[model samples]
Target: MDDFREHLMKAISLRKRIRDTRTSTGIGWDIIEQDYVLTWVLFGISRLEKLQETLIFKGGTALKKCYFGNYRFSQDLDFSVRGDYPCGDDLLELMIKACDIATQSAEDVAFTCKRYPEKSPHPEEQEAFDIRARLPWHKDFNTSVKVEVTTHEIILLEPEKRVILHEYGEHLNASIFVYKVEEIIAEKIRAILQFAKKLHERGWGRSRVRDYYDLWRILQEYGQQIDTASLPLLVKKKCESKNVMLHSVEDLFQDRLMEYLNEWDHWLTPIVPDVPERDVVIKELKQQLYKIFESDNEGVRVNRTNVGAA
Candidate 1:
């Protein structure tokens, strides 16, 4: 237990790493909580390496850790499993294996992980679990990291074993399979479209603004590297997997999208150092989307203008 706590204390920035992070980023104690969540996420990732072949690390968390460090502070650890998503006994077995790995790795502490029984209020395709840690602050040892494992979509490209970029003390190290930027970009576009269709049905808060934020970053950083010509096919497969039609560019660009954009400020205010202007992001993002995903048919462009007019 002494060694485990020792490594954790050093990994937590409060004593050392926090000073350097705050001096440059001007972050507050929220970062301390984020770093705390990160330590457990990384430690748990070490246990999850056994499923690397079937489970692919993904979502904004993967983007932040594997590819873009200091990008965003995401809370959940998201993954995509290949087929026949694990459940009941299968999931319990996976968590039990993870426990063994976690326990064996610890020097003296026998801290373990669990797959709890309660259901989270997430989408149907996704299932959530909590990683309970024996932190000194919690009286019941209830501190946790939220994890989502799903079979929501197909893997459009080969997953890569990328090194994790983290500042947790003592190199609390691990590497896992990650999705390609191309797949991520296509999915973000699909998500923006998918969420727009439902944003008004259930509630105003159904939209996820992170997709737009992530796409903006990808456009600025990885635009040249992506195979734009093949993006339409990738996007088609993604939307199809979710039972969503690949509507024409104009059909998907509607007032609902504008409504979705309006929530960007509320979504990103807590996570980023400087939230980009909502209009600027929407304007530039629309231009890039038209350039990349625009249909070759000239009538579609004509329809786009009239669609907005209507």
Candidate 2:
């Protein structure tokens, strides 16, 4: 009984701290609050039976949840699943189980899992759904924690087990399989190129400039440790799986790098306290990203660090 009371008190305290965080961090309360629930959802998925064996956590959320705590407020939980994916109904059942686990673990938080139809040209290549998390702190606000599972990726590197960072207690200490820094970097590169091609061909695209934010930032964090030689091959597999192609490393980004860099600050202003300067991010990425293809590139530092590991 006393424990429940303590949990309730802590939950209330968290609400106040969130407001303080918003003021200090200059991020929206909505994003900070939703990121809290996203952590729980990730923990819930980690606890799902044998699901972790098949699902490889990747994308921006993986960077935030598994690698770095100070990353952007990424709401989507993206995964690459091996073999046959569960059907819509079955996947929702699994998501419900995950939500139940989150509800059980977190105080004053409840999640309802649901799948909605997404209109995509190649819908069979990917599956995405969301679990709406109801927040006790905010009476009028609730947010969807998006879950995306894709069959379009081929896992080239062995998945690494990384510790999950939670805002609360030691009981939340759990780990899950995630993409190596190398693969995530490669895929983000492919994603950027893919978006760039669309913009050039159709004169309209999503302009997923966040991939650059992720690319440069992650490269700054994990650049030296990556296996530079294997990255190009990894990137090739990613692009091919998505039917996108990049013929040269020097020309990988083209004018698109600078084009998207222009939108970086505006797009990231809401999600992070201080967006990085455009010139700094691109300058660094251009130098290191090329090394991903030039296996023979000299002076390429190869210190494999364990900062991303448990």
Candidate 3:
């Protein structure tokens, strides 16, 4: 058993090295950039907690764990607060105060706060006022750090409503709790469909289509038990807004899903190879994620285990 365990560990390590190589060779640096961004967001969150404003992890990072394996890289940090809890101006003041406590200047951070503006059919229908902040830092003689902070309102839901939306109603989990696997898959499906339409409209590269296809495959393989009743509604809404064709969601489960799964298995699966300096990158990320969650001096805590082993 001990020998088997050692071999397993060795194999895992090798696989990780190969995966890392693949990521580095591709646009994986975007993921690393996102990690840096999240680090700054966590710093701001820590500051916010000092001022008595609680922030919860939401959106893609949460989905990275809840849907894609935690190993995937996410590009942004999103948080939501109760609509009636406080005004946007007050939240900015609190955030600014938190920065002051940390001896960080407001100009050094990307900070934006605003209410969700009304939506209409004008050309600017998508435009809304949002509070945004930028925190800048000098990393080295040539490198600098800038972190963006933005605040927006989501419909306030009762705890039960939030739970239902997070657990079953929505594809991505709501901010009210730890993200779940099912919600992530559902959200990704929605995102894929949306992106596909955008691609069709712009006549752009097939990246979005390919990613949507890949995500669909991953979800189908690992997300068979997901509740899918709301999927059609989600597809219809996103497609209607984007002016894209509404592909049958059932086709996602039946076919094309396996093709992406096979691609991931063949391309992403790690191979046993000696690679130095690999552990350093993984260790740094783990530490950063830990620091962000731990710095919330307030009682608010993220259910870290829910993200799973990755």
Cα RMSD (angstroms) for every candidate in the order listed: 4.3, 5.9, 16.9
Output the better candidate (2/3) by lDDT: 2
Which has the greatest TM-score? 2
Q: What is the C-alpha lDDT profile of model 1 across 155-240, one tens digit per residue?
A: 98988888777664546567778888788877877776667667657655466688878877777676887777777778778877
Q: Write the per-residue lDDT of candidate 3 for residues 35-94, one digit (tens) a residue.
A: 433443344444444322344444445444334433444444454443333334665566
Q: Give stretches of model 1 more than 4 Å off.
A: 1-14, 39-43, 47-49, 83-86, 96-125, 134-143, 200-205, 250-253, 297-310
Least accurate 10 contiguous residues by lDDT in model 1: 298-307
TM-score of each: 0.79, 0.86, 0.40
The predicted structure with the larger TM-score, 1 or 3, is 1
Per-model lDDT: 0.65, 0.74, 0.37
- TM-score, structure 2 vs. true: 0.86
The number of residue pairs in model 2 that clash at the backbone is 0
lDDT of 3: 0.37
Error of 1 at 134 (Å): 4.3
Query: Model 2, 69-150: lDDT tens per residue?
Result: 7788877788988656564577778888988999898777888887756765445657677678777755632787688887
